[model samples]
Target: MKFGKIIAAGVLAASLAMPAASFAADKPVVGLVMKSLANEFFKNMLEGAKAHEAKRGDYKLKAVGMQSETDIETQINAVESFITEKVNAIVIAPADSRALVPPLKRAMEAGITVVNFDVALDEKAKKEAGVELAFVGPDNRAGAKMAGEALAKKLGEGGKVVIIEGNPGADNAAQRKLGFEDAIKDGKLKLLDSRTAHWETEEANSVFANMLTAHPDIQGVMAANDSMAVGVVKAIEAAGKTGKIEVIGFDNIPAVQPLLKEKKMLATVDQFGQQMAANAIDKALGVLAVGAPLKGWVKTDIKLVTSDDVK
Candidate 1:
């Protein structure tokens, strides 16, 4: 009887020695898909998420991104892989807003919670796909408006400027153009024309060079993203007009800080990539672990950054 008692006591001690959260293994597995691994913004996002996971150690996180934004089929395959893996939740920054809907809906239908960040899926497409997902990112339209407002102020009333937009098909790019248009609506600044650079520095450079040839008297340029802004800066320098025209961009990418401080670029909007990504991970865990219902959208904050704010 005493031997049996000792054996039972040992079992109890072993159970007590294990972490209460040992059952955490049963916690939901989360999958994160980014637009591209090559983008610095997404790199920061990955780092922030990893830091959050280290601190919380709550659920399993499987984060991966596509090779490039244009690789739509690959992104879809990534989602399918997650579906096969049976992840409980997924947070995605879609490459092409409309193209990603079908696979995303499939994930949702498979009982996986979906949280979208950055670029938004097309509303009509989402409805047609028959799935509703939560969005966690900055208010893209409002953020762009803030940047455009600053650019307009720098250019002053009656200034002539041009816009360098991202991929035309992306919701963020279209929304940013609207925000820029809204800011210039005071009839003070005239938009010579807007062109899509498709989010490439080289394309932005070539496009801006051509725009400069067509509109040499333009006073300023508003680029939808820092990558294109880099190209704009190069085109300006190439045209021997550096510092002669005002340049502003969105996304305070670290690479653009030197130019900002040099006063080559006026300002950029910081949507706080790190915080947005970490928050999205927590939101996913909330829905998966605690049975928390995901809501429509959780818009994060945006701040303006100049060269002085680089550090």
Candidate 2:
């Protein structure tokens, strides 16, 4: 009887320790790739991802990004590194939507689950590449539509509004522009001109400066991102018409908050990038933990932030 008791205790101890070993071995690993670390929006996303990693003991995360938004090659290389490291999942805010497809497809084919956030993957390309990827991000078109509708409300129809866009290849930029177009189309807002600034503040400043010269009577400005929007405000100021025109921007970056608070800019769309990152991490981990299949798209919240929304 004593011998039987000893055997039972040994079996109980082995059973208890098995879970610890299993958990340690079974922890999911994810790689987070962003456009560029220089932008506050991407930095905020990284912070949210890291904070989530710290709180969740069941996963490990590593983050890497390009130094500039146009560095598609660097982004591709980063994905390759993650692939070599054999991470179970990859969550990326791609630098360029179409360019990242090949590398992302390679990862997916290598048995890694890939989740895209902040921008969308080209679905046609994904099909062509013969690999699948899951997407998580704000509805860029809807968010921009919100900003456009708010600007329309302020302008009250027939207001001449110009659009400054980001990199032409950026999926989010295109979607935001589409949203702006959709909103202004119904409102019959006169489009003075639209130009691409490649998500550069200086380029946007120069572009809007020229727009002001060509269309001095413009009543409003629509920007695909906050950086360009901030640049538009600078141009308006340079033209000595700062507070006269309604400027609406997307991505409620902190730098634009002052302009909003002072009522120089009408409103911005808060894409909630941090929340997007958190949700991406959660979904990526789910893929590795239980083979939870993330489907076509997982969109987060978006809000129209005005001067009143700032405080």
In model 2, state the lDDT of residue 285.
55
124-208 per-residue lDDT for model 2 (tens digits): 8768877555565568888889899999988987999999988788788899899999989978899989999887777899999
Give the poorly placed runs of model 2, Cα more than 4 Å off: 1-26
Weakest lDDT window of 10 consecutive positions for candidate 1: 3-12
Please give each candidate's TM-score.
0.87, 0.89
lDDT of 2: 0.77
Off by over 4 Å in 1: 1-27
Error of 1 at 190 (Å): 1.2
Candidate 2, residue 146: CA error in Å? 1.3
Candidate 2 weakest lDDT stretch, 10 residues = 4-13
| Per-residue C-alpha lDDT of model 1 across residues 60-137, encoded as one tens digit per residue | 788987776566788788899998997777777777888878887777667677766678788889678665555555
